[model samples]
Target: MPAYQLYVYEDQEKREALEQKICEQVDACTEVNGKIRNRVKKFLIEEGITDISEMNAALRVRYEGYLERNETVHVPITCLRGFDRIFLHRMKEELKTLAGQRKYTTEYRDQWLCLTHYPDVEVAESFLTSKDGKELVWNFTLECPRKLKMQIFTVLKEVIHTYEGWTRKEKLLALQRLYQFCVVNQVSDIETMTLEEEQKFALKLSEDLGEKKKNAVFGILRMSRKILFLQAPEINWNANVWFLERFHFSKERINPSKPVELVSFKEVTNLENQKILQKYLRYLFGITDLCISTIRIKLLELRTFLVYFNGEEKPIYEVEAEKIQRYLESIQRQDTREKTANGRIFMILQFYNFLVVKRYLKKIPFRYEYYLQKEVHVHNDRSVPEGVYTEILSKLAEFPEHLRLMFLHLWCTGIRGSEVCTLTGDGYEEKDGDYWLKVYQVKMKTYKRIPIPEALYKLVQVYKKKYQIGPEEYLFQNQTGGAFRYGTFRYQMLKYCEKYQIANGEYIFKSHDYRHNLATLYYDSGISLQAVRDYLGHEYEEMTRQYVDYMPKKLEKASEAYFQEETHSFAAELMKGEFHG
Candidate 1:
C-alpha cells in the first residue's frame, strides 16, 4: 500500500510549494506548446489536481479542494488525450458536460474499472484513446477474458468476503466459472444481446450441462450483476424483478423460483424513465422496511408498466390517461380475474401518485381515480362448515400425535398456515393464570399475544411436557423435533383427507381455512371486534370484520349474543342450523 499525506494546507506558501512539484513534471516534457500546456495546466491547478508522485507501480496524483485530498486522479501526461496514453478518467461532473467540450467521449471511465474482452493489443490500444468503440468493456473484471479475470479475482474476492452471507466466497467462485463459460461461448457483450438470443443461449447451456449444473449456472449468472453493484460505485443497483413470482414461498426466503430473466434497467430503455425509477426505488428501499417479497412486487409493477410502453421508448412520466386506460383494458384481456386486473389499476394509481409526489410528473396525468374501486367481492368460501369441522376433528383423533397437534393448534389459535410452523416455546408465556401465545405475523411485521383458553392451554402444556420442550424449542416441532415445514404439513393433511374420505370439493381444507374457522368461532363466542383484530394482527377494523361479513344478517346479530362457556364446545354452536343447514 502507498503511504498518504494529507498536506494540511496552512497558507499560500505551502500550496505554491506543492504546485511547483507538479509543474516540474510538466516542465520535463518538451513535446507541447507552452501556452497549450499551461491551458491544460490551469484546469488542473484550478481543480487542485496538482499533487503528483511517481509510485513503483504507477504514477499517483491527488487533487486539492476534495475533502479526502485524494480524489480527481488524472493522467500522467501533460495533456488529456496525449499518447504515452496514460488512461485519463474520473470526470468531476456529468458525462454531458465533458461530451459538449468534445474533450471526452460518452464511454469515459476509469482504466481500472474497464475490463476489455478483445485479445488484440492493437484494438486494446485503440480503446485507451476510445478510437475503437467496437471493443466490449465489461464493468466487472470477472466477466472479462482469462488474463483480466486473474487480475480482478483477488480484489473482487476481498470485496465479496465483506458481505454477511456464508455463501459469499462460493458465489464469487461460481461467478468466475460462469463468466469463463460465457467468454468461451462468445457472449462478449450481454447488455447488447437481444432477449431472445440470451434465452436461447441459456437454453443451450442447460441442454449441454445437466439440470443441477444448469441451475448452478443460473444462480451464479443471476447474482453476477448484484455482486458488481455491491462492489462498483460506477454501476448502480437496480431492483428489477426477474419473473416476479406469483407467490412468495417463505421456505425459499421469499426469493423468486427463477432469477435469470435478464430483466434490468436496460428494459426501461428510456434514459429519463430509468433515472426516475432509480431515484424512486432508492428512496423506497431506504425508507421502507418492506420484506424482500413485497419489494419484488413493487419492482415487478414498475417493470410491467415500463415494458408495456417500451415500444414507443418514450419517458414514462410523459404518459397520459388515455394510455393508462388502454393499458388497463389490455391488462383486462390478459388477466382472467376482474380482481387481478383491478388490482393492476389500483397499483397504477398509486404509481401515478408516487410520480407526482416525487416530482417525476408535472401533475397527475391519469384520470382513473374514480375507477380505483374495482368491486373485488370475495366469496366467504375460506372456511369449513361446523359439520365439516366436527367430522375432521373426529377423524384427526386417529392420526399421529404430531399431525393432531398441528391441526388443533391452528384450529384453536386461528394462526396462518406458515405461522404454525414458526412458533417457538418462548412464544408461550404465563400471565397471571392465563397463558398467551406470542404470534409474530410475518406479513404485518408485528407481534401480538393471544390468550390461550382453558382446554387448548392445557393441551399446549401437556404437549410441551410430553416432548420435554425447552423455552427456546419450537412450540410445535416435527417428529424429528425440528421446526415444522409447510411441505410436510400439506403432505400430512392430504394423507389424512384421503384416508378419511374428506374433501372441500376437489380442494382439501387448507390450513388457512382453519384460521377462518377460528374467526367465525370467536364471533360466535361473542368476542369483541377489537379483540378479534388484536388476535389476528389486523391493522384495521374493516379487515377484522371481513371474516364475519359473509354470515347471514340475522346470524351476525345472533352470534354477538351467543357465547359457548366450555370454549371447546364453540364448534357445537356452528353445528346448529344457524351455521349449518
Candidate 2:
C-alpha cells in the first residue's frame, strides 16, 4: 500500500476503507498534522473524492462548467492540498505532456484559470506574452475582480515589456506588493491611486518590510512611476518629494555593495528639510566640480546633520552655534575618529557657507574653526607582508580564476578594489610597445593610465575572449551583469584566504594594502615621489608619501647610506663606530 499507488486504485470501496485505516493510524500518532486530519475528514465527508484521477476529472468538469457560465474556473484549497500529497508531481508531468500535445496549461489566476485552457486562445496567449510574461505567467496570480485584474494585468504587461534588465524584476516585485495593497485598501484602479493613497501604501511597506528592503522597494516604485503615469495619466504622485525621500545614485558611480542607506537618503523628515537637502544636492550636482562619489559622501554627512534637527520646533534655517555644538558633542559621544569627525565638521561648515551664499541664511551662524579638530594624519603601515602574500601566491592556482586575476591586479598594479571591480574590457590598450591599463578613479573622478606586466595583459585578453565581454562592458561582472562589487570581491577573497589557510590561517586580506605595497616597492626602487604621485593618481605628493610604507630594512639601508657617506654629517659622525662595524 504505497502512498503513490493509492492514486490508481480502481475499487472505490476498498480504497476508502484503506484510506480510513491510514487516517486512523495517522490520528493515533502523536506527531500527526492537524491540517492533514482536517483535509482528509473534509474530503471524505463533503465530497468523498478519494480517487486521485477522479478528483482531477471532477476539477476539469468544474472548470468546463465555469467556462460555459463565462466565469473563471476555481479550484478549492482542499483539493490542492490533496494534490500536494499525491498528484503534485503527476500534475507537472501532465502539464509537460499537455504542452507536448500543443495544449499549454500555464497558471494565470492562482487556483483558478489556466492561461492556455482559457476560453479564448488569442487572449490567453496575449496575457502570456504580456508583462514579465515568462515569469509572471507561471509565478503570480491576481485575486481581485475580473475587471480590476484585467486592468492591472494590462498595466503590468506594459511594465514587464517596457523596463529593461534588472529593473523589470524590481518593478514586478514592487507592483505585486502594490497590487496586494490596492486590494486591501479597496482601491479600484492602480493608475488612479492618489498621492495620499501612495503615501499610505509606502507607510504600509515600511511596517511590513525591514528598513533596507523598504528603501529598495521605495526606490523601485519611484523609478517605475514614469511608465505607470504615462500609461495611466490620472495617477497623482509627487515625483519631486519621492525623488528626494529615497532614490538611487547613478549605478556607474556608486558601488552596489555599499550600505543602501548611505547611498540612498531617506532620513530627512520635514518637507522643508527635504527641499533644502534636495536644493543642496542639486547645487552640488550642477554647480560644483565634485565627483558623484564625493557628493554622495557629502550628501550622507549632511543628511545626518539635518536629521538631528528633525523634531525641533524651529526649522534648520534658524541655525545657532549652541545647536551645532550639541550636534558635535553628540557625534563625539559615539566615539567618532578624529579624521572622520573632522570631515563631518567640514561638511557642516561647507553647507552653512552654501546656505549663506544662497540667501537662505542672512549670515553664518557659527565659526567653522571653533568646532573643528586638528586631526593628525597618521600614516598607517597597511602593506601586505611578504610572507603572507607569498603564501597566497603559492595557493593562488587553486583559487577561482576571477579571484586570481583580481588579486594579480591588486598585487601588481596596486589598483583600488573598486577600480579592479569596475575595469572595463576597453581599459587595456597597447601603446609605445608596452601594455597599459586604464582605470577610472572614483575618488579623483578621472581616468588613470599605467603600464602593466605583459603576462597579466595576455591573461586578461584570454579572459575577455572567454567571457565574450564587449568593449565597453565590465571585465568582471556580478550575477546581475553589473560591475563586480568591491564588497563581494573582498568577501570572496577572505573566504578563500581562510579556506587555503593563507598566512598560517590568520591573514585578513585588505585590498588597499596592495596599493601600499606597490607604492612602497616603487619608491624603494628609486622611483621619484612625483612619479609615484602620478602612478597612484594622488593629487598631492604628500598623499603619495603616506601610501609608501618604508619597511625597517629600507630604513636601515637609508641609515647605512647616510653614515657611510664621506661627507661629515652630525648623525653619521655621532654613530660612526656603530655604522662602520
TM-score for candidate 1, residues paired by index: 0.55
Which candidate wins on lDDT? Answer: 2
lDDT of each: 0.56, 0.67
RMSD, model 1, all Cα superposed? 17.8
lDDT of 2 at 551: 49
Candidate 2 local lDDT, 153-177, one digit each (tens): 5556666456654676666677667
Q: Alpha-carbon error at 575 in model 1, in Å?
A: 39
**Residue-wise lDDT of candidate 1 within 1-581, one digit each (tens)?**
22333334344667787678666655444555565445445545665765422210111122112212424434233232321222222221222364524533323223323221122233333434433321222344234444334333433444343542335434544555555556656554432333444565567657877777667656654454444434444433343322223222243233111122223555665556766766665655556566555665676787788777776666787666688678866776774566666777777777778888877776776566545445555546477777777777878878888778778877788888677777777787777888788876667766777877677777777888888888888776667776677777788787877777765434475887877677767876888878877778888977666665445554656665565355526676576645556
Q: What TM-score, computed on C-alpha atoms, does each candidate reach?
A: 0.55, 0.62
